[model samples]
Target chain A: MQIVVDLNRCQGYAQCAFLAPQVFELHGEEALMFTPAVPDDQRERVHRAAAACPVQAIVVGERAGPGVR
Target chain B: MQPDTLFQRITDYANRADPYPLYAELRENGVTRQDDGSYLVGTYHEIAALLHDPRISSDYRSRTHPDEAMIRRNERPPSFIGLDDPEHDRLRRIAMRPFGPPHSPGRIDELHGDITRIAEELIDAFRGADRIDIVDEFAYPLPVTVICRLLGVPHEDVPRIRAWTNAIIDSFDFTPGADQEKRQQAGLDARDAMARYLGELAGGRRGHPSEDMLSALVNDAGPEGRLTDVELMATATLLLIAGHETTVNLITNGVLTLLRHPDAHKRLRDEPGLMPRAVEELLRYEPPVHMLPQRTPLADIEVAGVTVPKGAPLILMLASGNRDPLRFDDPDRFDPEREDNQHFGFGSGIHNCFGAPLARLETQIALGALLPYLDDFHLLDDPPPYRRSPLLRGPRHLLIARG
Candidate 1:
């Protein structure tokens, strides 16, 4: 599954990173870096991370198409 | 029994120990409008959505009938917690710089050793003691000391700071009584005095540049520019208080809940790996801050099919939402291994608890250290004395005896 983070909306609360550290990593206080393509092993964690995002900044699956940044 | 007084009764000191049943009633009522012109939301989905809603303002000044005492006390501008973005986001970002990732990635993790050591020291003091008050001796001092060291404030100042914090917290009491004015004044006075004290401490850190948050904030010169003297004072005061207050409740509540559920306590002691998840459960089951008492709506918002007008006091019952049956399976049960636990313990959205990482580590260490002794622990008070403020809810003292 593909993932996209609306960086503008992401306040870097790091809930995503905390839940799915392999898929999402916070570079600094506010800069969040993530793996767009979810790995098989991390799919469950990514889903949990998406749900836990405070700002709902993370979009996953079919809705998270290209150019949605 | 008018439904409007639900919020009032919930805040009443009598229900302080266990407000869950009332919360269930509140969830059944949906979004309720109180007689005092405030709105109380207790449902899980509604509270979660409202937390993420931009229409919901955290600023108390936005209320139609803003507290005059609060207005006067906040003459120096409200802290970022009380401000809306882009202002809140800006100040919060600047403040986050020296404390967490990506600016200072290891800041909180680095404190793990210190936190463990501190927890051990506090527990060590309980040696040869037949009984102890966890709040005064263990829970309270642990977080306060950690926060002080992190902020570069001298540990000796805690007693004075504690007075200021107590007065400030007492001001948050929702009940209107004859002493309301006096309590508000004390809170305002405490805030001002605390601000002045914090400001002086930050001022001393300028150019000296110690390895502390206060010094980092004081010496900061990033692209976002510096927090003005007043802003610095407000921010410093916010950090100090926020860092100190809530975590105490988290730790104390953990102990209380553990003692109450001996089975869970035994499970934790046997399988210490569950400590982190247990902490999360404690947050959901018995959170520190029960309600967000000072939120306002920017526009007429439809919450749970109720049209809440703008400028109305919006009290989000966080602890209630934590126990909403619709949100969790067997919501009342304390399951350490519970998965997908996205709790309102630290709240959500932009105003989420800033000190969460540190608070979590501190609690884990604090409780993990106490696990060995909990087997012999006997609660001296089943329903321990709770603090006055319903917002930052927790026992004021948890008395226990060790066999």
Candidate 2:
């Protein structure tokens, strides 16, 4: 799975960072860093983090399983 | 037929108890133009779109009138919430440093225990009283005490905090012909008082570091990311006000709503696991912030096919949008087991509420503490008296009697 955060759209809510700390990291005041690829274990959290973003800035790709769309 | 004077009616103090019907009327008309030539966007999708639109500006400088520029210019430095991006984004990031992730990843999460203890302490006092004013005795104090501890402000100074907060909030009315100068003066005076008070506390924390946010803000960081004295004061004052004011309403409104809907109240008590989503539902059904003031369009913006001309003032009716039937099934009814409950309660886009995590934690803990008491308690006043500020809507006094 892949994670994409629209940085311009991000308001630094940091909610995503809290929900999926493994995938997302916040630097100083102006920067937000996160891993692009989501591991199998981190996928659930990444999705929750995306849903938790107040601005809806986090976008995640399709699920890992065979049932995925 | 057009919706005549509906905006005014919605804002009128008389309708403070309930404005959902008027909001429904507004949605029916799509994006609406009020008598003042400004617009009120009431639908869920339209409000959400405008909130994310770059053409939409939160800065008061984009306003057309002469008095607006003068009033906003003369005031103390604008809070990040009132400014557009680059500046807004920068200040918000700086402000978030001590409160949220990367630097202090566990800050808000750590407060969960403190919040629960605080809620429990306040709720414990209700055991002896024949009747309790929930606003004064419980709901108001819980968040105020929590914010005071977080900001490193002395808990003894809450009276002054209340006075200054009231003055600052009173000055924010955007109704066409409200008394601007007196309110502005009051707001400035309050700002000065709070700045001087918090500055002294922050100044002491400069050399000796502490665990609180004020200490981190004052002692830590390079000159580049550091907030200037004025900016610090403005940011601190904004946090002080923004931190507690709305949360008080959310908790109080949550209790009131739950009491009104007995089944939801009982359900919450039985299934404690539902607290998080229940709190979100409370936010949607009776949100603390009803009307967000003054978003100016940098260019002519089309909302729901209605052309909002450049420089026109648009009021984003957040509470109205939360109840749009087009967005939710049976929007008027309160349901704790709501799905896809992406609400405008904390707002959307860049200016979305910075203190939301803490607010949610505070509300979740607060309602948990109050739910048991409410099983046997009832509201003294069915539609209790409301605070004067329509923008920050809640009961001024929620009297509860033991049954």
Candidate 2 per-residue lDDT, tens place, B8-108, comes to: 77877778898888888888888888777778888898898888899998887887752553465446678788889889978877887788777677677
Of candidate 1 chain B, the 10-residue stretch with the lowest lDDT total is B101-110
In order, what DockQ does each candidate have? 0.14, 0.24
Collision pairs in model 2: none
TM-score per candidate, chains pooled:
0.89, 0.88
lDDT of 2 at B394: 91
Clashes of each: 5, 0
lDDT of each: 0.86, 0.82
A49 Cα displacement, candidate 2 (Å): 7.4
Consecutive 10-residue window with the lowest summed lDDT within model 2 chain B: B65-74
Docking class of 1: incorrect
Can you write out model 1's per-residue Cα lDDT over B1-403, one digit (the tens) per residue?
4334888788888889999999999999889888878899998899989998998998878889987765776676799999999999889888988887656666776686899999889888986789999999999999999999999999999999999999999898877789989999899889999999989999988889989999999897677888999999899899999997999999999989999898999999898867877888888999999999889999999998899999998999999999999988999999988876878999998899988877877888899998897788789998999999989988999999977
Candidate 2 docking classification: acceptable
Instruction: Please name the candidate that would achieve the greatest DockQ relative to the true structure.
Output: 2
